[model samples]
Target: MRVVQGTRPLVIFDCDGVLVDSEPLSVQVLVDALNRRGVEIDEEEAYARFLGRSLSTLAQILHDDFDHSIDAAFLEDLRHELYDRFRQELKPVPGIAGVLETLDSTICVASSSQPERIRLSLSLTGLLERFEPFIFSASMVENGKPAPDLFLHAARAMKTDPADCIVIEDSPAGIEAAQRAGMAVFAFTGGSHAGAPGYSERIAGLAPDVVFDAMPDLIHLVRQHMEGPDRHRSPRAS
Candidate 1:
């Protein structure tokens, strides 16, 4: 059943840039790995092509699209390297804990990253306790973001109707996926990549329900969405 407007909706957060400040580090590993193998792509290209996308698709691009036959072993190596870097460098997004502490809705993580990767980062950032066991990964389904599969899979797993789930994401692909799944999506534009020169324009083109740059503002925006013009029910205060 759709979560009625007045009721608190299920809140699904994307892990990389939303919950943890790990995108730059994640893409850094990819860029360095590819360059070491003489692929020659820079961080900008990596972020443009792979940020918010799936690792499996990235492997396909390396093999089929770029003619760089990356073996599964290489992918495993990268995964291990990423985990190490995440443990050392990952930080929770600023003020995210406050929002998590106060939100009244059921919360879970639905991400494009591997389940292991998701857990590692969240654990490092001290945010895993809130989302443990309910984590959903794109690999669980056939497709990831921009296909609606992952979000819909998460919705089913969380036992929440698509319409009643509000996805907080940080990528264009994530926003597109939530829309395709018929959920309201709000984009987090406060990450390191969000400061890129053309990011604002790109996000505007996607046209999410709302764009927020600070983690503290998330609570207010979510409350406004839950308590619309008719004022069904105010979001619970912490």
Candidate 2:
């Protein structure tokens, strides 16, 4: 077990694809809901567009792409239905438990998901208690992913500087947001979105500090970063 010799670094994680295995279920629910309204969208396209985005953003995309009106009330209902149908199926990605346990850093979750959804997903995945009160929702900020607001908010909440925190994300929007926040980012490519053709290159182009296709590899990278001679220095943007 590699150890990070740093003075307790901070790590912020994105929830959906990074913590809980919810992206596929989320995409499926959106597809089913839209299909019911007579809108036909490819699941792959929906996943690409909706992953790491806020519900309001998704609603707008739905309306713009299909010329359909789905009000907040209907959207809430759809989410409730989806949660009820798939909540039991939610689970953490492989090696998450070990990685979290081995971390020498303070950890928190910062996600585009609503607080309630974040609670529900983490709870269902048996990881809710691990974060306790450190979980943050994008609703807490004025803007969601692709905007630096949420990550900045998380850094402030953690009482850490953006340069001292590491962000773990699985979506392009998330990677962009972390970069914009002036934080080093690691793209996790171990979920439903991993290796989705050009995923690696797309994330690389965003200039994440690092990218990992597996959880153990990510943990090892974090350990290495923490143990490196320049552990206290802020990571340079690529």
Candidate 3:
């Protein structure tokens, strides 16, 4: 059953690159882990292949492209190392804290990352309490990004019509997922890894409703999109 739209638009955020500047750390950890197994991948290639994807997707890609099978032991070790790196170095995306403090809409996190990782990322960055019980993960849904499942699940859980939600994302997969779910999406390019060659171009190809690199500009963009007209309305709305 479809839910009724709430008076306040629901703002869904992607955790890794959007809320916390953890993409670089995640890529480096993944690359290092793959190198230990003789994969010889670089951070750039890693980002191209794995950014915005879940661990299960990463395992599949490693198996298909490199003929390397990942076992439970390897995944456990990788998580330990990744979490350690995150603990030591992770920081919230620049200006994100300020945006959260001032943005008036109801917000939640819908991420491709596992639930534990999502909580840890937000908790570490001092942003968890703002959206703790509202956090939704790909693990809670059957499909991840580029699929509408996760985003739709979030809308249902939040009791908001998909058409009345806004997704803030930093990856093509995330933007596409939001569009597939019938939500307005804004592409955020302020993460540490945003400068990689061709990254911005790739995101532009997706044609998200808005693309901006400064986090402080986010609240204004959301307000404009909400107030300007009904053009942002989703086709999924009945």
Best by lDDT: 3
lDDT score for residue 131 of model 3: 94
Badly placed stretches (over 4 Å) of model 2 are 1-5, 195-198, 229-238
Error of model 1, residue 200, in angstroms:
2.4
Better of 1 and 2 by lDDT: 1
Number of backbone-clashing residue pairs for each candidate, in the order shown: 0, 0, 0
Computed on alpha carbons, the lDDT of every model, listed in order, comes to 0.84, 0.81, 0.87
Candidate 1's C-alpha lDDT? 0.84
Per residue, candidate 2 scores C-alpha lDDT tens digits across 1-238 of: 1224756668999998898878888888888888887888867778677778987677778778878888778778787887886556778888888888887689999999889899988888778888989999888988788888898898898998887788999999898888888787898888965645566667778777787878877667877777666533332343
By descending TM-score, how would the candidates be arranged?
3, 1, 2
TM-scores for every candidate against the unseen true structure = 0.92, 0.89, 0.94
Which regions of candidate 3 deviate over 4 angstroms? 1-6, 232-238
105-148: candidate 1 lDDT, tens digit per residue? 89999999889888888888889899889999999999877788
Q: Give the TM-score of candidate 3.
A: 0.94
Model 2 CA RMSD to the hidden true structure, in angstroms: 3.4
Of 1 and 2, the candidate ahead on TM-score is 1
